[model samples]
Target chain A: MSRKLSYREAMREAMHEALANDPRVFLMGEDVGRYGGTYAFSKGFLDEFGPERIRDTPLSELGFVGAAIGAALGGMRPIVEVMTVNFSLLALDQIVNTAAALRHMSGGQFSVPLVIRMATGAGRQLAAQHSHSLEGWYAHIPGIKVLAPATIEDARGMLAPALADPDPVVIFEHAGLFNIEGDLPDDWSADIRSARVRRQGKDVAIITHGGSLPKALAAAQTLAEQGIEAEVLDLRVLRPLDSESIAAAVAKCRRVVVVDEGWRSGSLAAEVMARIMESAFYELDAPVVRVCSEEVPIPYAKHLEDAALPQPEKIVAAVKEMMG
Target chain B: MTDHHAAAPPSGPVPWDKAFALRLLTDMLRIRRMEEKSAELYGAGKIRGFLHLYIGEEATAVGALHALAPDDNIVATYREHGHALVRGMEMGSIMAEMYGKHEGCARGHGGSMHLFDARTRLYGGNAIVGGGLPLAVGLALASKMQHEQRITACFFGDGAVAEGAFHESLNLAALWKLPVLFCCENNLYGMGTALERSESQTDLCAKAASYNMPALRADGMDIVAVHEASKQALRTLRESAGPVFVEYQTYRFRAHSMFDAELYRQKAEIEEWKTRGPIHTFTARLKAEGKLTEEEFLAIDAAANEEVAAAVAFAEAGTWEPVDDLLKDVMTPPPPAPRPGGGDAGSPPAAAPCEG
Candidate 1:
């Protein structure tokens, strides 16, 4: 049996289940408790779980995030919520220098079993400070796992396994997809390792993840109408990218268009393109193209923001150009 | 501040019993001997990278470590040879680590700046100025939540006082009332920058007190003072299950690192501070109190020198970790292969390098 659920509801249900199942699991971040989460994901959680579990922290990103790492070291599973990717920069030292490096530095004596979830990507005219996808920057690190849950099933199911993993895992929840609805099957489960084929086709592979997944799917629909079949691949895991799945898609389609919400230069799209060149260069039917955000701070103006982001029309245009 | 002299020569009677007092003196002697040999090895090119010696700060580490239980957590700075030694990390492992050998504490991965020992619950030799504070706070948070009778003692230099991490970590620990003992080793200088030059408020305990935690100060060059202050702080932390901060007023007797030119401070100031060297002053006091004799002091010094020589031999015999295992321990290894019959299915492949 399957039921319709929004991404926000599914994620909420997932967190509720995690908290209920494990006494060691607790959520701590700015506005996570009494304020019901900055995005309202934890609405009414404080009432049910009380102050001890659903902790509301001050705007001390470096302090709280580092503390979460310490707690994880002290034998507790901790999930930290950074309100947005932009603010996570304040805590980057803990994430990169400490959490990521601890296991290797300690000669395999310690592993930080921590999950950090943050809102990423641009869409709601939140302006420069609130928008911008830096998941790629995090993906560039060596010791952590990066996940972008694009669908309801993933938003609901990724948290459990992420908590189960022994190393630090970072999940990017696209701010734009919270209200989007989809039918989540009762057996929905997710693995935090590989890319998933959202829509399979043969003409072109539209490779993307996070907020760009829906845009690539929409472009695939438009391409289907034009008698061209496009394969949509969601790069669910970014750090340890699923090169096998990416190569499989490229081998099948022979042409690729990478859609990323981050800027074009040194972007996730660039990484995906590099991987295609490295792994499946012989399978290329055409030069791999990318549809990424314009190289500018995401602005508040709606039209300008739309122009800067990777939209359905942009993905469609890139794929069409490749097909031609 | 430069205005302050060598702290009136740490005047006090030796209060501990003869055996306990001698043990403290012996630990201090061990650190001094080991680090002096480390300096020679660095000059000889056996120990490479930045070697930050904890020469003058021995009293702080020896005193504070003896005050805490073996199970309590310790997070320390890059100049952590003394802390690791007092915390029970073998002297040979510390020397081997500095040699970048696999037998070292961190398997040659973490050199002088990142010594970590799980057996002693010593979290790290965190190189960043204020990096270890948050980890200490977090460990304290875990202890409190799990109702464990353990506290986390985090040590950083006076330079870390200027870092935002210092302010933020203190606030978080105090706000949650976590069992953390923030040990600020005020060695008067952070790298080359003097404390007054770096901070507007020169009093470190004032800053910690501003975060609503009780803060204390001790004569860092005097092991008895540091040990007594630490004991008092730990007692309060355990009783209240809250954070406490202690400022150990001390000085570094050597250059910040092997590469340091030390152009910032004057020769007279270093010489003046050396008069109150923790080892000699404590030995003199013990002699005056009839707890230690000249023969006993010479014997202890000789023993420490012997241990350092043996440690160097151990380091010279240590092997290098192969480049083939470079990526090992970067992430946890995958779970043991699934049961034979049923066969584990749907397990994500272990994270391997993209280049491979």
Candidate 2:
């Protein structure tokens, strides 16, 4: 049983289910209530769940994020929606320091069962301040689990396990995926771990996640038309990264090109490439390559922004280069 | 700029009954004695890491914590040995925590700046200047959402008021009307930086008032004043949907930490604040009122010293956590078996990490 849903609707359904199912679950963030959500993923949620669950918080990221951590510790499951990855920097101290460190620092007596969701990536032309992708920066931290839901199934699936796990989880929703429509399976068995092969082939593996997923798929299609088979791998879980899947992809297709919307210098693509070398070096036919955002602040102009990000043509070029 | 001086003599008689007055005096003595011993231990190299002594700020923790119910949550700053002790963490755990022993409340991992105990509902001795405020706000939000009648007490220094977290938390707690008692221990300086040097708005109560919360100022060197102020504030919080602010105007009698050079202030400055030391002034007040005799005072002093000594021995006898288990608490122990009402949802259904 499958039903068509926009990625945004799938996410909203997941949140609605989480709220209706758990008495302790509530949503709080800026404009989540009245303004429907910065992305409209939470439109009509307040009317459905009322003000108690769909809380509108003051513009205080550190305050609310930390408070969410506390609420988690105090026996409420809080889903904190930081408006964007740009604004999440203000709450990074709380997210990285307090929420992540509390369980370990408290010697296992406390765990922050908090889920923080924020829009990430640069396709929105929102410029450097609002459109940067920093999920890799969050993925760098050890205390919390990071998930980038690239597909409608992932958008439908990741939240339940994230909430069920007794630790802090950050879900990064790419600003580009909200309107994309796809079918969601009734039985969503997606866990908050492992990568999935969106398109299987034998010639090369294209590794990517979040907003880069569609571009990688497009690149794979172009490669297919040119008779160069490509396997597209979507890294759904960023932290506690499913290196095994990366190895499996490598074992199947010896060469890999990681496409990421973040910058080339110290990006999640770099981590993936490093892991591929570490785990599947012997299997590689050529050195692993990457197509990442240019190493500069994302510019405001459309052509420059597209050039700065990982695009379908760039992915095709990178993989074609890797395949040779 | 005004020169530093001790707070004036506390006015009026001991408002509390004799027994209660003696208990307050006893708690201040306990903190003062424990801190003195901790300083001595640091000299002996028994306790390492940042040791922030709450020596002169005893009245703030003892008085404010005494006003809260046992089940309430307490979030304290790094300089919170007094807060933990007054909140009923065994003195032994506190000492062992300072010594970095496994038997310590946080299993020795927290050191001096991160003492945490689940049983006492002590959230932490949060080291960041204004870090604990948001957590306190959340805990208060939890209580409010759950319809629990408990309040959350958050303690921080004057330096924290300058932090964005302090302002943000104040606004959130006030805007949401969460029941959080924000206790600002204005001990003149944050580490070496004096309050006046850092904050343009020196009046902390006015800052809290800007958040639309009622703010009260107390002489932190006077335990009775602190207790009275906290009680009044908490009463308002319980009656109204409030997040109250209490500024305990006090001073630290020692260097900010063991490593501090004390370069920011003069010796005369510390000497001036010591005259109004919580222990001595309270002792004098109790003595003048005949509520505490010199012999009885000596008994309390003797008891505190004995307790701190035993704590040091317990810490000395404590053992190290085997290095093999370093990653034990990094993630939670997996959740328990599901109830019949729930679906089995956790545990990533792929190859788990660290397993071959």
Candidate 3:
């Protein structure tokens, strides 16, 4: 029995459930214990799970993240939350070299089974250092699963399967979706391998994930007002991207517009476009156009931040462009 | 402190017998010969890419590895030809890996710096400084959690001590009382930078002690001393108290890599260290004790040369992986399910009972 909850509440519930159910599962990150997480995601978890499980780590991304990987390899289910994707750069070596490569490098003898969660995307006037979506970079690596839990159901469900997976899984929780509320049905079980179609349509397919999903859906609404029905596909699993579902959507819609919060050059949207070209090129009515963040560091000012990110209006424009 | 050189030798010639000593010497010599050949191969452009040789540090790996059981896991740095050789990985496969051939232990994916053998429980040839330390800690953690009687021996250079992974691994190992042997080869130089210039506290043992773990130092050039220290450390670690740190004061007889100009240290310095090389010093000690003669030493050298020659031939005959199957081993292939009636059923009958 699930109720409508915000993305932040959904994630907090997932952590709370994991801690309550699994004795070995623990949460460690900056401000996750006492300060209730940087975005107030784990507000009262310290009191509930105690300091041991809901740990507050020092501002050592490389140190703590590497320790989390070690702890995972040590037979503990550790969920390490890096405050932002920008800060995750400090721990990239551990993530890419150790967690992602260990299973394959060890000749399938070991698996890390770690879950690294971080808030990505830029739109809150957080400036350059605090903002940036690098999920595309993580998605490029093999032997690791990449997930973008954009919906409330996914925010609630992704953690369990991620913990169950043998290999390492990196979950990108966009900062913008934290406060957005959505319905969580009673039988909401999220699959880590398929893309969920948030809205059904026939004119065009709006392929997006993470923070861009809401914008894509909103743009679809705007597109519906203009008599062009757009289907919104939220790519939950980003790494072994559900290409079959994407191909099916492309084959049905005949036109596609990808909206991603990452930069335009070499983004996950580019990978999706390439997949469409490889699998469903003949079914396309027009060339796939992408509405990605401008190739620049996210700005601090509200207007520039909005301009630098993929906004609903921009996604609508891209859909209209694809339609013509 | 009284000099222990004249002290009574342990009852009946210590723990190592003649066969074990000979095997240790053979292992060191094998690494020495293989590395020498690899250097020659590098010069001739047969083996490309970065090659960090473990020439003078052979005793540190050979002696320390001999102290560990076959079930124990080993994680080593990029300069791990010695570790891989002593860890019981096939010499031909390791050489083939360095040659980037499909017959390599890692199937040609990881070359000189990344040789891995799962059968021997050798974790990696990790190139990142202090990278293997945490992995060793984790392996030990797994053993501790699973109640397995195994210790993980991690080898890294003095340069890796400066990395955060080193500190974090030490703290975690101590905090958890994990059975990990942190073997730091204090070669005194990190690529071009020396230990004195890089570290504020040059005493590596003191740093390990700060984490509340047992720490010791040994003359890495002396193979017997390295063996005794490592054996004691491994014994303590296997008992599951906590991690132990052994700082082997060693030196590199050659350039850091083939491309290194070696402007960081002096030529005469290398010549001075070469005087106390592990191979010669240990051979001299064995001869003095009547355990080895000049002819026996020549035989060991000849055996190492033959082994290396055979490895080179194997690598030369090794093939390259086909480009079409580049994506293999990225993930483990799902195992084939068992048939319903216990017979081999191709692709499993559609209505058959699901057997994992």
Q: How well is candidate 2 docked (DockQ)?
A: 0.50
Model 3 lDDT per residue over B166-250, tens place: 9978887887688889999999999999999999999898899888888877888878878988877776665647898888889
Q: In candidate 1, which residue pairs get closer than 3 Å at backbone N, Cα or C atoms, i.e. clash?
A: none
Cα TM-score of candidate 2: 0.95
Ten-residue stretch with the least lDDT total in model 1 chain B? B347-356
DockQ of 3: 0.25
Write one digit per residue (lDDT tens) for candidate 1, span B35-154: 999999999999998999999989999999999999999999999999999999999999999999999999999999999988899999999889999999898888888899888999
- Candidate 1 residues A195-286, lDDT tens each? 99999899999999999999899999999999999999999999899999999999999999999998999998899999898889999989
Residue B277's C-alpha lDDT in candidate 2? 82
Over 4 Å off in model 2, which ranges?
B1-10, B335-356
In candidate 2, position B44 carries an lDDT of 94
CAPRI band of model 1? acceptable
Which lDDT tens digits does candidate 2 get at residues A1-324?
888999999899888888878878899999999999988878999999999889999888999999998898888888999999999999999998898888778777788888999999888788989999999999999789999999988888789889878889999999899999998776656767679999998999999999999999999999999999999999999998999999999999998888889888899989999888787899989988889999889999999998898899988998777766
Against the hidden true structure, what lDDT does model 2 obtain?
0.87
When only the first chain is scored, the TM-scores of the models are: 0.99, 0.98, 0.98
What's the count of clashing pairs in each model shown? 0, 0, 0
Clashing pairs in 2: none
lDDT of 3 by residue, A213-306 (tens): 9889889999999999999999999999999989989998999999998899999999999999998999999999999998888889998889
Q: Who wins the lDDT comparison?
A: 1
lDDT scores of the candidates, listed in order: 0.90, 0.87, 0.83
